[model samples]
Target: MLLAGEQWAARFEEFQREAWRLETLPQYLMPQESEELQEFRDGTRIDPATVHNEYTDRLRRQATQGRLQGRVHIVTRPLAEYLRFEFAWYYAPHSLAGERIRILDVTDRPNPLDGVQDFWMFDHSEVVLMNYEPDGRQINREVFEGDPAKFIEYQRIAISESVSFEEYVTGFDL
Candidate 1:
């Protein structure tokens, strides 16, 4: 929703309200420090604050990049856990000492016309193989990478194996 812009992105206050709402749900199970205020009274609050700042920074960078509306998928259990932890402590209520959040320091990428393109290639970090469908849907599969150079070779193979389109314009107006 953040990627689609203001209309789809929930305001901070609204997002907080939703998180609280989620807490009230019967089936919602959260970690110890995130379950309630009691969890933090006995432990340290510094780590959670750092993580919260990092998450906020990530979102801020994405917003600035015009990729704020880009979709994020928690593919692994650890990733999901961290997301929940960040939201529950830093974002939802800052249960640990009311920590302040900040945006991340993200690098800039080239624009669309700059000849560089972002493709749905394989990602080792996420452990998934990305394949595009004719209707624009993406198919992610689990694959192994024994050789580092296999990525370039596989991309070449896929491109050669697929059909492509071309435009035949007969007139031009300068």
Candidate 2:
């Protein structure tokens, strides 16, 4: 079934134990990040002191409350500029706020988790696949009616093959 708009997106808050995501996109045209993306392109660096928001605040709360929240972003070396900017402004701060961030760099090796698009697997039961246009504009979220096992396996493979965002960054210039 297709879930549209804020109502569906808000499902992130309903996860009880875990809310894990697999990010396979090089860029996402998120409207909220427009100004930040521009500043990033203009060569300004992200400042950690001012990155907190209601979202990150929720992440912190969920984390301390023992709920697992994280994502493994599939990427390649010579990272896309957008990915770099996102890491600097979103991933890093979110990690610090208690959302785990992992990177599955597919630079020199074959991707272990191939053919995977962005998705959120919540509580190991519900799976929501994110649909995006070729240019990375979000279309909508589709809830899978199939078994969650496949998505769960993908999550395992991703987590096993990836590294923490901090560790991943040490190998790059970002």
Candidate 3:
């Protein structure tokens, strides 16, 4: 089943214990972010520390409720522009709000999770696969009805192989 609008947004709030995500794309073309992205590209940037938005609000709320929210993004070095924007604008602030963001840099090594698609796994049981076009435009979110054991295993591998977002960004200027 495809999830959209409130149905999709509710998953983050509905997860009882943990909400995890695996991000496989370097750029995600979200329509809502177009204007901000363009402004970023045009040399205007927002200080993540002072930025307040719905996402960060959600992260803060989840953290206050003692729920875990985490994600590991698969990426390569000499990062894409979109990845840079994402790191500076989204990841940085989200981390401050208590989201556990990790980076799996596949620059020199072979990708361990090469064929794995992007997905969100709620409470380690419900999986929602994120479908995207080649250029990174989001298509739809599909609920995966199969057993989520593989996704749980994937999460294990990702967390073990990746570095925390703070560690990953220490030397780089994003």
Candidate 4:
């Protein structure tokens, strides 16, 4: 089944224990972010420390509730512009709000999870596969009914191979 709107949003809120994501793309073309992306390109940027949004607000709440949220983005160095924007504007603030962001830099090594699709696994049992177009436009989110053991393994591999977002950004020039 495909999830959208409130259904998709509910997955985040309703997860009982933990919510995790595996991000495989370098650029996600969100139409809602078009204006902000243009602003970034135009040399206007917000201080990540001051960023406040619905997502970040949710992250703060989840942290206070003792629920966990995290993601590991697979990337290569000399990052894409969208990635730079994401790191500066989204990941930085989200991490500070208690989301555990990690980076798996495969710049000099073979991708360990090469064929794995992007997905969100809630409570390590429910999996929602994120389908996207080649240019990074979201297609739809599909509910994966299969056993989540594979996804759990993917998460393990991702965490084992990646560094914390703080570690990735420290002294690292964007």
- For candidate 3, report its TM-score: 0.97
- Candidate models: Cα lDDT each: 0.29, 0.88, 0.93, 0.94
User: TM-score for all predictions?
Assistant: 0.21, 0.94, 0.97, 0.97
Which 10 residues in a row give candidate 1 its minimum summed lDDT? 17-26
lDDT by residue (1-174, candidate 2, tens digit) is 898777686787788999999999899998989999999899888665567899889988898889979999999868888998999889878988888899999999998888878899999999999999978899989998989999999999999999999998875544
- Number of the top-ranking candidate, with lDDT as the measure: 4
Per-residue accuracy of model 4 over 104-171 as CA lDDT, tens digit each:
99999999999999999999989999999989999999999899999999999999999999999999
lDDT of the structure predicted as candidate 4: 0.94
For candidate 3, lDDT tens digit of each residue in 1-174?
Answer: 999999998998899999999999989989888988998899887777887888888888989999989999999978999999999888998999899999999999999999999999999889999999989998999999899999999999999999999999997776
Instruction: After superposing candidate 4 on the true structure, give the runs of residues whose Cα lies further than 4 Å from its correct spot.
Output: none
**What's the lDDT for residue 172 in model 1?**
12
lDDT for 36 in candidate 2 is 91
Candidate that beats the other on lDDT, 1 or 2, i.e. the better one = 2
